[model samples]
Target: MSEPTQSSPTRPPTPSALSSRSDRQFEILILALASVIVLVFVLSIYLLGSESWPALQRFGLEFFTQRTWNPVEGVFGAVAMITGTLVTSLVALAISVPLAIASALFVAEYAPKWLANPVGYLIELLAAVPSVVYGLWALFVIAPVLSRWEQGFFQDPARLALYTSCKNLWDSGSTTLQCFFVPSTFDGRGLALAIIILTVMILPYTASVARDVIRLVPQEQREAMYALGATKWEVISRAILPYARAGIMGGVILALGRALGETLAVAMVIGDSQDVLKSLFGGASTMASVIANQFGDAQEALHRSSVVTLGLTLFFLSVIVNYVARLIIARLTPKGIQ
Candidate 1:
């Protein structure tokens, strides 16, 4: 009484169904990668915060406000280091920005193809050189030159008198203009050296970015200006620079980030002093330089934690710099580019 039942055939998946499945998988993969990056960033912050917690609790606000940093006496403060870091980085920026921009302008607009390629390559090559090598070069080669220069400058009767007057003013509790002119003990390695090295180190970052952005200025824009009988300088100043300014600034900020985080080279050249920045040629320390120099010698737990707190401070400072850079770039970017 059993009749044979026909088996139903299975159908293959439709093209649209397969495509939808693939899209979901790709989305999930991208999301997972992004999530990993976010997780790592969060974990880094957590580690720094936890390690620095003891120092934070111990020092309260004085940690950032005071200038003394004696490990033996258990005294700790960061004002000098913070000020040195800012002064060196900003001064380096001031020195390098114009040179970088000029180099970029030449490579992008003035140079022939043959010259541009080689010049650009050389500029980029500077970035690939290790920080330690630069440190050594600065120490052995640049330091002696600077030391001689300082000696010669101070030998001048007029300059020496001016310096002595400033020193007297500083010793008399005047912290304003006099403090900056009063010279520290002569040494090849100091704030001026650090600024010079930092300028060399960050120059390529800005130059590369500026060159790229300059090149991206539309050919049509240049043509339009030329058709109106605009000179080459006029075209560049009026049409190209305005369009590329935002991107160029992004590069400068990125260079600042590099300058802020630089360690060994800065530490080696910066004289490792905890005193407030008194002169351009004076010994000083930065947050990164102090961390590099002192972390190994920090035998006490609080001392170690204080060093870690410096790291935390540098981290937040870098984060703030990057965030500000993003805001500026976003605000300045042209609508057409967006």
Candidate 2:
């Protein structure tokens, strides 16, 4: 029995036992890397809040309600800028979402491989173009066409009379009537132009994300719908789109964030007016546009703080938008996936 006895074979280490010094070091490294983003985000908020405290103290809630922005007079408010930002972003979202979704559907479901690849690639490439380039293009190419149209519209006697009547109503304390007609002074380089440029600028973001998400819908979903005698459109609308709605929504929100934060392009074409929006074609300024246009020239401490406050407001606005988007996505996502 002693002669027959042998040493037992060695066993492999368990996963827990296999955690070596290198493994721990790698994990620590990953954790440190992940912490950097959070650190940066918190630091940004702190810096903005510190710099903007004076403005916040002085204006309180009035900063958002007041429309005046006079650096020389030491008065500043964000109502006009905030309105412009929201209007431009929302209008751009409304225009881009449908077009982007349609393009994504065409590329993902209808187009053959030969066509889909190129079209999808081109759409994705649009996002790579710089904002400055889009501004330059819009300023030189698109703005002139819009200006011509405006000139023609104003030249018509009937339209001119209608605008005059609206102006009379506006002067008679019917302030809301101003939305019905373009400002007589509008030269087309204002809210309408800004909306158009923002729409184009944000289109690629939604399209690319949607295309990828639509493609990811399971084959079984399509097959099941098809077996039930669904048409192609019906299958897509009922089966695939429902499954991919969460992802499509994510893309729409991403585009909206882009429209909200767009600076140089909007500043270049937004007409830079500091008044409340009076018409679709009237001059207006967004928060990002104001910050870009005024920060360097902000000589007074209050003025500088006000500019910083605008930046802070924009930061919070973006955070709120993303948080709302997350909630919506969570609610829309299938329970099984959640």
Per-candidate TM equals 0.84, 0.85
- Candidate 1 matches the true fold with a TM-score of 0.84
Candidate 1 lDDT over residue span 302-333, tens digit each: 99999999999999999988887778767666
Per-model RMSD to reference: 5.9, 5.5
The true-structure Cα RMSD of candidate 1 reads 5.9
- Candidate 2: worst 10 consecutive residues by lDDT? 1-10
lDDT of each: 0.88, 0.86
Model 2 agreement with the true structure over 1-338: per-residue lDDT tens digits: 12234445674343453567668889999999999999999999999999999999999999999988888899988998999999999999999999999999999999999999999999988899998998888889988888888788888998788788877765674556545457635566888889999999999988987887788788899999999999999999999999898889988997887899999999998888786776777678999999999999889999999999999999998898777766765665543553
TM-score of 2: 0.85
